[model samples]
Target: MSAGLIDVHAHWLPAELFGLPSGSPYGAMRDQDGELFLGDLPLSIRTEAMSDVNAIISDMDAHEISLRALSPPPFAFAVNSSSEDYIDEYNASLSKVVTESTGRLAGLGLTRLDDASAAARQVADIAKAGVLAGVAIPPMLRGASLDVGVLRAVLRSAAQHRLAVLVHPMQLPRPEWSSYYLANLIGNPVETATAVASGILGGVLGELPDLRICFVHGGGCAPAILGRWSHAWQARADVRAGSSIDPRDLFRSAYFDTVTHDLAALELLASHAGEDRILCGTDYPFDMAEPNLPAFVDSTGLDRVALQRSGKAFLGVRVPQTELQ
Candidate 1:
């Protein structure tokens, strides 16, 4: 299948944002600050010159990827600690870069969810910016619940704008997770698990039935543990009292990205979530991503038709057989 694959998950950071050194340790850090601590990878390798739009295009040409959806570097998510003026300037700069890559690439805009109306207005503006296909928001904003008035307001406005939500988790506690290196190994997955758990248990999905949300890292281990959650709910009154709806049903309504990094894991995700709910993802410019991603996905157990249709449907594109494969 040499069809034009559309990667729904990837990240890019322009070099300009990180030239100055500024960011916090526990809170979200900027590219430059992260580079200083995490070493040269953030600055020297993952930025514009290193990521190389031309190189990505060449790689796509060889791999047959027609479209790629770009995300801000994970560090950009931490910009909430900066001034609102800085946030606006940062977003505008990102929008300009992404829009220029319009034909071959699309992007998801980022927003701080603390102010619902301002967030809603940003959503509307990004939609009209003619660059972004969706909005990427942190799973929990400042300590706000998914079903809270603020989040619901933003979601309603997102729904009105017909934007999909790409939910990623901010980094978690460092002390308890530090020893085990669990911040990513365990903490990241747990953060997403808790977010999905909260959304379902709180009945947020039921409220906004039409909203489209895509979960990264194969929904961060939600599929593997959903049954345990269900059993606990049945056995405990307090758990059952959280919401009347079933957690499994909510999982079905959402989507997952194919960044699991193993054939068996991918097969398990498909079994747990169904084929139609899965889409391709590479987590690009990160060392953890597959070296030859398109070929790896091509060889997965997924039905070719399902793989081809998933991205097109997510982007609202009508894929002809020739265009898709």
Candidate 2:
């Protein structure tokens, strides 16, 4: 078997997901054009490709990518007013896509953030259906904290079922984010770091050691800012009261993907998060996705063997057996 690259942070939606009236009445998303909008702001994604797995596979082939860990684009999870039929349809469609892909694709599931029990059930059900890479989540669902009991229930269930967690931000942090694609560039990392800290500072990471999570966008500066976060934790008793452990000391439980789009950022992520905690990723079919992951890895200053090892440990991707030798 030949060595293959796993783009672990890619996004995809079942074709049926698009063009449907949102239960949340996300009227902006249902404008008949199938375009993406963050906080009612339109994005530039080509809606047609989102539902087309063949187009996605062609993209993988062109990029020499063997497998992509597909997740519902963040918008899908924003459907706060979803119906059971809607949720079931989304999960089943995801499983169907992965099942038909013949090992070229794996998927993550979408769940409700407002209701933890429902989210837990969704996670287990999706896992039972063989869609096991993990489940898709936003940094903060609506305005709730990941550290809250409701979200904790979901993580605990994730631990029980052995499903990985993947985090993305649902919307930009501020109205100003509408300018310069700031949501994807700035809000994305900010949200990731904040969510990761909830696990680290909230004691959830220590409680659920079996849980595995991969943060997209090179962990969005969490690796770059550990020193600041650590200092704050030490300088303020209030901050220390949150986790009491050094900020740098506990993030070994966290995993990150190589979507930083900067070689320097990738190096910082590997060093800060540990080389093994970093995995291959490409936010495919989106403008910000790395164009050439193989090339990015080759030039990131980290050794190929170590990076590959780290990705394998974090993702547990099953490459062809011939390559295992």
Candidate 3:
């Protein structure tokens, strides 16, 4: 029983998801001469790698990943009522892939974040499906922060169903970040941090103690700014206006992925968030994905066994000690 790594942050977008019905929000998505385009905006991703399950497994074997959790990319999230049908179709298709993976894959379902009630119902359906381990949501929905709008219902439903939540950033373009690809490089991490702050400061985490949520991109910039947040929370009434829980305390309860792309940063995150709460992750099939995830984890000097356990714990998958050992 060799101890193999579990990746909790890889993505899978089946080719069938691209064939959206006419009324869907992303219905215009089409492959144009080998490039994927959504309404003429070219998406920069490896379509072949994202759509091929056999290739994904071969890559995982090559990279030494034992199991990979699959989630639809953020673009597949339902932003409007018109997207409900498409999102449902997407989740159904994703479940099929999971069923055929023979335990090599787990899936995270997507929901219609634009409508809280609909999203909550979808969360229930996702749990009832039994093949999905969690739900994936964007950190922001339609220009508002996640903590503000329909997310509360979604979070509560996920907690009730014991479904872990993965908060991935949408990477929407901003005027200031228009050039230099800052939308992805800088905006992504900041968006993740904002969601974490919202969860902690907005009383969401305190309200639901059973929620198992993991933030990706090494929890964005949240770990690095804990001290500053603690200081402000202690000194400013406005900072503690709604929630009295300590930022550092609740932040520790949350989970983070190992995608910092820097050893010192990973070490800092471990120091702040505790190594036991860290999980292995590779933003697979993307340009920003860690090229050598296993080697990168080894380079960080963190315990690989602990990370494997954390990933299993996040997905609520329990394995015997003998198997892990």
Best by TM-score: 3
CA shift of 124, model 3, Å: 1.4
Arranged by lDDT with the best first, the candidates are 3, 2, 1
Residue-level error in angstroms, candidate 2, position 60: 1.1
**Model 1, 161-260: lDDT tens per residue?**
7777777765556688876557777776777777777777777776667777777888887878889877877788877676777777767777788888
CA lDDT, every model vs. true structure: 0.67, 0.73, 0.83
Of 1 and 3, the candidate ranking higher by lDDT: 3
TM-score of each: 0.85, 0.89, 0.93
Q: For candidate 3, which ten residues in a row score worst on lDDT?
A: 20-29
| Model 1 alpha-carbon drift over 4 Å, by segment | 19-46, 49-51, 149-152, 179-181, 317-321
- What CA root-mean-square deviation does each model show from the true structure? 3.5, 2.7, 2.2
Global lDDT for candidate 3? 0.83
Model 3 CA deviation exceeding 4 Å by range: 19-29, 32-44, 319-323
TM-score of predicted model 1?
Answer: 0.85
Error of 2 at 96 (Å): 1.0
Which candidate number has the best lDDT?
3
What's the residue-level lDDT of 76 in candidate 1?
A: 61
**lDDT at 305, model 2:** 51
Candidate 3 per-residue C-alpha lDDT over 1-325 given as tens digits, one digit per residue, 9 for 90 to 100: 4467889999888777776434444445567676666677677765667788988999899987888999987777776554767777878888888889887888888887767787889899899878788899888776666567788788899999999999998787789998888999999999999999989888888888899999999999998898999899999999998688999888888889998999888888888889988999998877789989879988888777788888888988664575476
